[model samples]
Target chain A: MRSVVSILDLSTSEINELMNVADDIERNPEFYRSKCKHKILATIFYEPSTRTRLSFESAMLSLGGSVISTPDSKISSAAKGESISDTVRVISNYADIIVMRHPKEGAPVVAAMKATVPLINAGDGGHFHPTQTLADILTIRRTKKTLSGLTIGLCGDLMFGRTVHSLIEAMLRYPDNKYIMISPNELKLPEYMREALDKAGVSWRETESLETAMPELDVLYMTRVQKERFFNEEDYVRLKDVYILDRDKLKTAKSDLAILHPLPRVNEISVAVDDDPRAQYFYQTLCGKQMRMALIMLLLGII
Target chain B: MNIDGVNNGIVLDHIKAGESMLVYDYLKLGRLKCCVAIIQNCQSKKMGLKDIVKIDELIDIDLDVLGYIDPHITVNYVKDGKLLKKRHLALPETLTNVIKCKNPRCITSTEQELPHVFKLIDREKQIYRCAYCDVVGDNK
Candidate 1:
């Protein structure tokens, strides 16, 4: 069975195909209802996640498919110390497809290897979140009107932000995509990522100030400083409030600049900016569900 | 200091100096019952100093491990006091259980039965990263 453990698992043409399906789903939701009539989707979350779990559930529901979920790990077999492989093998019997989120990076990879059905990695520690990249891409495609020839700004915790890493991987496949990575030196993008960008011959620059890169961005993807990924509380405390995207920051950005966040926001994004026309995070959430729907169907051979 | 030539075994030559112990440990030569000789810090015209390992009996050697440790090392197979073949090493495309990933957040940290897998990501730099977490493996 085909599974999506990383954003790289899908080719550029496949991503375009998924985006097309997502767009169609958004336009005609009723027409695509009952596509997965008798199929079952199992969301086995080893970590607490309201947004992603709900998105998968809603996507399955919209497709007229059944869902079996473990919303919290503390209550699941994982808390009893069951291995990801064993749990996934068991779950594969009950579900046609699986979407998982775990605190350990590569947990979903292990799950995918053992799963009899298609497995989707919703999030795996700080590794990959391919579906989130799909959602981000769909959002960028709709808002920016094109995936190429745009200055994409990735801000905040570039190091621990799985979404940022996945986005960079996905965006580089397109042509003329320049990345303006904004973050403190401590949270700079990993050397491998820099190497990938260099190998791809993509133009990218690093900066400590978001305002410096704001004006040139067509799409600005903001990420939270993940405290769980940090080794100590002191470092998390110091870096948490480093970059706040307030109205003042928006004033420096282009009017057409699309600000996107994989939400569950803290003070990193001022609430006042939510009302700004440029803010597309909420719309990004909607796109997330649609993309999940597209992905589920694609993996299940329904599309 | 001279070590006898192998009649029907393997001779590992041109190991970078100071890395012979690593090659021994990785090859698990200490576990073998066969006679194995390790010669270290020998002067050379090409290399300033090098190490050599000679085994008196034919034994399976993990060439990938040796290559990963040092690509310049060469493996000489001997049979009936004659050199059968000389094998050069290159960075392996992938390694399974050669080294464990140090990332605490990696799945291998919790899964006891999982094999530690790393892929050669940068051939020029000889960098290997964990297949699962993409964290760089400590080549040292």
Candidate 2:
């Protein structure tokens, strides 16, 4: 696909191909560093996601490319009545590609249509974050050596976690990937997600008990439930502390289990667990840069 | 009961009662120079209550739209005051520019060049999803 709007846009083979490229870059970062010399990447973030915005900028900069970013929509012409359509069109001339994150669900899709250059959706509301999922897939591929044949445990907010949504959709294409869904009843995985899994014929078990599912899991993807994403304050207050992963909780998990989180995590993951050998969320962030680098090259048809 | 039959126009029969006005407005029947007659709430043997429209001239009508709004409608073509063809309506497999994609992230919202289109993914459930955003659209 010319534009990366959704993870599903890339076929399984294409995603596998990207994984290979990410592996190569992860091993030999220097070789790909100068690949995008003189090229420009524009990151337009309508929503303030520091990690995502910075990752895109770092990915571009590491590739010897320059970045021209409108980090905040309010700071950009959008505040002065400019639409995302016009903004993307204007930036298309200035940049080789665009990475966008917007509060509106389809804002990036709209920008993509108007862009002359390739577009990457960083994260569109609760819609999709193909890049982060790329980072996720890369981390999984690197750590586990395969995208298939593992039981993945997705914990915490399944309702508003776009990462979980994209990752589940991406991973289900593989063979024999079981999902252990751990969430409070209030924050259960949405019906549409269940329908997708069911439609794919993937076997998944749901439980409120993460400890019971921890031993069987190869990977535990913990997510934070932001108060803003929750509609009702009372529900948020009750469920936000529902799944706090401490060292005690990690004791139940397998020794080789990879713990993943799409971060800026609140209290979901304990700060005390950061030094644990299995806690790979930091590596996940660095892997995010590599994946974005590989992704930039792949999307630009460089590799 | 004394309404005159059409000479060369189309007759829409078996439209659900109280819904013919929607079809009438949607088809832009008022824009047509031909005489148009909307007979609403007419008693029918099969439908119990139905609406009918008789036109003086055969104007362009979106038959798919007629089916989408009220699938039970039947269209009859009149030629020189004679019955020409009778067409039964069925639900369209897809609809274009009918339901707006509510998902703000959808491509069509900003891409003015793109047409708002939806495909019927589940016939049994009558579920339609936007081609771009995958936002579900109601059958109605």
Candidate 3:
């Protein structure tokens, strides 16, 4: 069975195909209303996440599919000490497809190894979040019309943001997609990421100032400074408020720039910017559902 | 100094000087009951100095660990005091339970039964990344 543990699992052509399906789903929701009539999706969140879990549930329900979920690991069999392998093995019998989020990195990989059905990694600890990358790309495709030749400005926590990492990997597959990585010195992109960009021969530059990179970008992807990812509370507190995107900051940004945040955002993006048409983060949520629906259908081989 | 050749055994040659002890530790040579000789700092022409390990039994050793430690090392299988086959080494594609991941957030760290796995991502740099957390790890 196919399992999406990372963004690299899907080829560029496959991603484009999935996006095409997502676009069709967005335009004609009634056509896909009962596409997954009898299928059951298992949503297992080992970590407490409001947006991703709910998004998966909503996507399944919208497709006329049933969902069985364990939204909180604290109250599930995990709290009593069950391995991801055993849980997935059991869940596979009950569900046709599985989507999981875990605080431990590569937890879904373990689940994927044991699952009989298709497995989707919703999110993993400070690692890959392939679904969010799908959503970001879909949003970009909707507004920008092409995945290539755009200046993508990544702001806030580049170091520990799984969404940022996943997005960069996805975008690297396209041609001429320059990256302007804007983050504080302490939260700069990891050395491996820099090496990857250098190896790929992509145009990428790192800067401390978000405002400086704002004018050059076609897409500005903002990220939250997650408290859970930091080993030190002091570091999290110091960096959490470092890059707040208020309306004043947007004044220097391109009018056509699409602002995105893989959210449950905590003070990183200001409420004032929500009124701007350029702020597409909320709409990004809808894109997430559509892409997930497309992905579920593809993995289940129903479409 | 000279050591007796085993009738049926394996010989490890051309190990970089000062790394034989590491090879010994990694291969758990101390746990073996058979005769094992770790010859250190021997003369060499190809290399300035080298080490050799001679084992008195044809026991299976982890070639991946050996290759990761030093790819230049030569393995000679012996049967009845005659050389059977010579094996060369290269960095392994994947290593299972060979090295533990230090990343605290990796699934292998908490899961006691999970095999610690690493994959060679960069052959030029000899870089191996943990399969779970994608953190760079050394052979040590």
Candidate 4:
């Protein structure tokens, strides 16, 4: 694909090919550090962000590429009502590739249409975060050393957790990847996603109880119940602390079980678990940078 | 039991019962200067009961909207009181600007010029999701 607007734009082999590149970069950092020597990476963020914006910038710098960025659209010309298409059209002239995050679900898609340079969607509202999925898959592949033959429990905010949605979709492409959806009934995944799993022949079951599903899981992907996504604060409050994972909860899980989160987390994961070797969220954060590196390299044909 | 046929016009047949007026209003058949006959809950051999919209003037009709509204609709072209062409409708694989995307955060919401596109994800369930954000559309 010329641009990565969605994870579905990538295939299983291409996913692996990128992982291989990320793996190599991890092993030989100095050798590949100067690969994007003369290139420019632009980060266009129309929404407030932390990890994703920093991750893309960090990835670009690690590749020895320079970056031009709009970390906040409020401060940019967008505040004066410049269109995303016009913004992308202007930015494509200055950057070799664009990594954009927007509060609107398909804003990057609109950017991808207008961009001459390749576009990478860092996160587009509650749509798809393909690069985050890349980090997720990379972390999962390295931690478990395989993408298949495991049960992954995606807990909390499944309804608005785009990462969970993207991760489930990406992981289902592999052989025998089972999913256990753990969430309150109010936050169950959309019916279409369940139907998609059914059509794909991926085995999955939904449960309200995390403790019930904990022992069987090989991986637990925890997501924050986002305050901004809620139309009602009461519903968010009721479901927010529904599944706080503490040491007591981890006692039932497998010893090698990997805990992953797309970070800047609110207490979905107890900081107590951060000390546990099973907590791979920090490593996943680092993988976020490496995966973006591999992604930029792939999109720019540096690999 | 013969319903009067139209000459040099269009006939929408086999529409789901009680949906003719919505179709009539949706297609904006009121704008037609010529005779427009809307026959609802008519006895049909194939469908048991159906709705028919007969336009006595040849006006541009959106087959996609008719198909999207009800896949079982049959569109017939008539000239000189003889049927020239007839076709049945099926659910469209993709739709543009037919239904507003329900997701508040969807691209179509903020990007006012963006086409609200949806792709049919489940044929049996007649389910369509917004192409941009994967938010399921109201298939109603």
Q: For residues A1-303, what per-residue lDDT tens digits would candidate 3 score against the true structure?
A: 899999999998889999999999988999999999999999999888888988998999999999998847898999989999999999999999999999888888888999999999999998999999999999999989999999999999999899999999999999999999999999899877888899999999999999888889999999999999898999999889999999999888888999999998989999998999999999999999999999999898977
Residues B28-96 of candidate 2: C-alpha lDDT, one tens digit per residue: 888988789999989999989999988888777788788778778999999998899999987788888
lDDT value for candidate 2? 0.85
| Global lDDT of each candidate | 0.93, 0.85, 0.92, 0.88
Candidate 1 overall Cα lDDT vs. reference? 0.93
RMSD in order of candidates: 1.4, 3.3, 1.2, 1.9
What tens digits encode model 2's per-residue C-alpha lDDT throughout A74-160?
777878867777888899989999998877666777778789999999987677888888888778878888888999999998877
What lDDT score goes with residue A206 in model 2?
A: 92
The docking quality of candidate 3, as DockQ, is: 0.80
Model 3 — TM-score against the truth? Answer: 0.98
Model 4's TM-score against the true structure:
0.95
- lDDT, candidate 4, A89-208, per-residue tens: 999999999989888888888889899999999888777889999999999999999998999999998988889888988998899988999999999997767877888888899999
Model 3 CAPRI quality: medium
In candidate 1, the second chain superimposes onto the true chain B with a TM-score of: 0.96
Model 4 chain A weakest 10-residue run by lDDT: A69-78
DockQ of 1: 0.79
Full ranking by TM-score: 3, 1, 4, 2
User: DockQ values for all predictions?
Assistant: 0.79, 0.36, 0.80, 0.67
User: Whose TM-score is higher: candidate 1's or candidate 4's?
Assistant: 1
Q: Which ranges in model 1 have alpha carbons more than 4 Å from their true place?
A: B43-48
Worst 10 residues of 3 chain A by lDDT: A68-77
Question: In model 1 chain A, where is the ten-residue run with the lowest total lDDT?
Answer: A69-78
